[model samples]
Target: MQTVCNIEQLRTVVNAWRQQGLRVGFVPTMGNLHAGHISLIEEAHKHADKIVASIFVNPMQFGANEDIGNYPRTLSDDQEKLVAANCDLLFTPTPEIIYPKGLENQTFVEVPDVSVGYCGESRPGHFRGVATVVCKLFNLVQPDIACFGLKDYQQIQVIKTMVEDLSMPIDVIAVETKREASGLAMSSRNNYLNDAEKATAVNLSQTMRWLASQLASHNDYDKLLQQARAKIDASGMKTDYIHIAHARTLEPATQNDKSLVILAAAHCGKARLIDNLQVELD
Candidate 1:
């Protein structure tokens, strides 16, 4: 696998691939390789002639008080994982390399109302950072298809909206979230969990399972939302938000719909965990 750390070099390689008439798939990540991220790489590998993955811990996407400084930086390990997955190119750029100079003057992409809910509401300017950086990467890598995990359900929605609004040519593919056997979604933050905390983390996924049962048996949206909120609260985790909405529109469902997503984020000590379940509402 070839690894390029600068945008110019990446673009040069991408141009060469384009000249060869090869299709490229891109997977953007923050550098902690887990089963979930590998799942995206696997999907991309299957779909494209070449797979390009990026591992940049984007500072812009992090909040002032967030764990930007402490977020894991395992480049070598990430490279090994991606290479094992048969990734063609790994674009690992530094912040200065990506932002260059006068980053403040650069145009940004934002989704108005959808950006105001769930994780976006909890972390101000979070999605804006995500949007700006993703747009930049799309320009840099310029892949035919970009793969994103559905672990960040709202994030997938935001990126899809950004791509549509900007008319980017890349197809945005949503890969399913990989979870532990206990049902806890795999996350880099899972490292922060102590033994006891790991058990508590199981509640994050269990809550989603319970809601799926609720939605499956009946079509009471409000009741399901209320019960979910109560369950999360009673689980001793401070709930950020529990949303049962139409997967595409992201609006709260007034009636049972076919595509439904149950997303929740909560705080467990210093670790903020997010998990979601996408299902057919039948």
Candidate 2:
């Protein structure tokens, strides 16, 4: 795969693809490549003639106390994975290039309502950073489709909402959350977990799965969620939020809501993990 660091070079290559009438697919990531990320690129191959993947550990998406400096950056290994996935182009830009005018004056994109609760509540200004960088990437790459993992369920929703609200001409495709045999959602942050914490991490996805099964028989969303929260807390982790909400809006799921999802976030040792399971009521 050809790797370009500057926008002009990236545009020069992508524009040539456009002139040739070839459709392009894009996958934006924060390095630290894993099976889950590769899965997105694989999915992108099915949608467009060419795939473009980007790895820029976005500082805009991280908070002051967040692990931006320590976030993993395995570019050499990541490049190998991308090439194996048959990605045609890889855009790896520095933070300086991404924010040439400095972050203080950089224009940002925000999708209201959908960006308010869940992860947003705990990590303020997080989605603002996400929306902004994604918008910039969308502008730079100008792909026909962008693939995101459903592991970050709210993030996919936020991006979808942003594209629709802004009328950006690109389709946002969400690939299924890749997981281990133990049901732990594969995440770059999983590297932060110690031996004991790694064992406990599976409980996040396990609890989400169990809660999904209960949805078919129970209408008491509040009680069901409280019980799930308690189960996670008893497993030696601090519960951030264990909520059942409308899949699209992220609003609290009501009895009449047919499409719903069970989303949870918890802190175990130094890593904060999140997982979700979608539910369809008959």
TM-score to native of every candidate shown:
0.95, 0.98
Best by lDDT: 2
C-alpha lDDT of candidate 1 relative to the true structure:
0.87
Off by over 4 Å in 1: 216-220
Clashes of each: 0, 0
Model 2: runs farther than 4 Å from truth? none
Q: Write the per-residue lDDT of candidate 1 for residues 1-282, one digit (tens) a residue.
A: 999999879999999999999999999999889889999999997779999999988888788899989898888898899889999999988888877774576666777767778888899989998988999999988999999988888888889998998899989999988988988889998878887888887887898889888887776777778888788878878788888888888887656478888889988767899999887865
Model 2 scores a C-alpha lDDT of 0.94
| Candidate 2 lDDT trough over 10 residues, lowest sum | 201-210
Error of 1 at 71 (Å): 0.3
